[model samples]
Target: MTLLICAFAAIIATVKWYKDAPEGNMKLGILCWMYWGASIMWLVDAIFEYAELKAEYFTPAPADMLNDAFLGLAVVALGLIIWLVWLLIKDPRGVVKAALIRKKA
Candidate 1:
């Protein structure tokens, strides 16, 4: 479940990044990299767990699935938060700079 969610997020971010490939302003590429990295990490984890659990891996408990879902959501939310903080620090549109200047006026 976590793998599925992360894979979906990575695909969406990749597509969005491709669409705005010409524009380098928002730094969306970084977000794409983060999500893709997470997806790959989860994929590796799934593979190792499957190897250990074999066929039983297919049938996880409902509670476990719920927990995985929550974790996936949390992971996605954390990625977004990090991206937002980075964007604010970068201030691609100069909004932060303008606000600071206004405060000085």
Candidate 2:
């Protein structure tokens, strides 16, 4: 579940990054990298767990499934939060700088 969720996010971010490639913005690319890395990590985790659980891995408890889903969502949200903080610090479009200048007036 975590692998699937992060893979989807990575795919979406990759597409968006490709679309905006000419603009040279780094944020989308950063997001893509983060999600893809997470997906790969989770894929490895899944593989190891599957090896340990064998056939039983296919039949997770409902509670476990729900918990995995929540964890996946939380990971996605945290990635977004990290991206947002990076964006704010970078201020790529200078919105924050402009706002501060305006405030000085």
Candidate 3:
């Protein structure tokens, strides 16, 4: 479930980044890398768990499935939050700088 969620996010981010390739924004690329890395991590986790559980891995308990879904959503939200903070710090478009300068007047 985590792999699925992160893969989806990575795909979306990659597409968005590609569309804005001319802008050469680092934030978008970072977001894509983060999600893709997470997806790969989850994939490896899933593989090892599958090896341990064998056939049983296919039938996860409903509660476990729900928990995994919530965890996946939380991770995605956290990634977005981190990206927002980075964007604010970078102030790529200078909105924050402009606001601060205006306040000095």
The candidate maximizing lDDT is: 1
lDDT (Cα, tens digit) per residue for candidate 2, span 2-48: 78888999999899999888896657877998999989888999999
TM-score of every prediction relative to native: 0.91, 0.91, 0.91
Clashes of 2: 0
Question: Candidates' lDDT values, in order?
Answer: 0.89, 0.88, 0.88
- List residue ranges in candidate 1 displaced over 4 A: 103-105
Candidate 3 lDDT by residue in tens digits, 1-105: 767888899999999999989786557877998999999988999999999999999899999988988888999999998899998899888888998886644
lDDT: the better of candidates 1 and 3: 1
Pairs in clash, predicted candidate 2: none
What does candidate 1's lDDT look like per residue over 1-105, in tens digits? 988888898889888888887876887887889989988888899999999999999899999999999999888899989999999999999988988886634
What are the runs in model 2 whose C-alpha is more than 4 Å off? 24-26, 103-105
- What is the overall TM-score of model 1 with all chains considered together? 0.91
Indicate the residue-level lDDT of 1 in model 2: 73
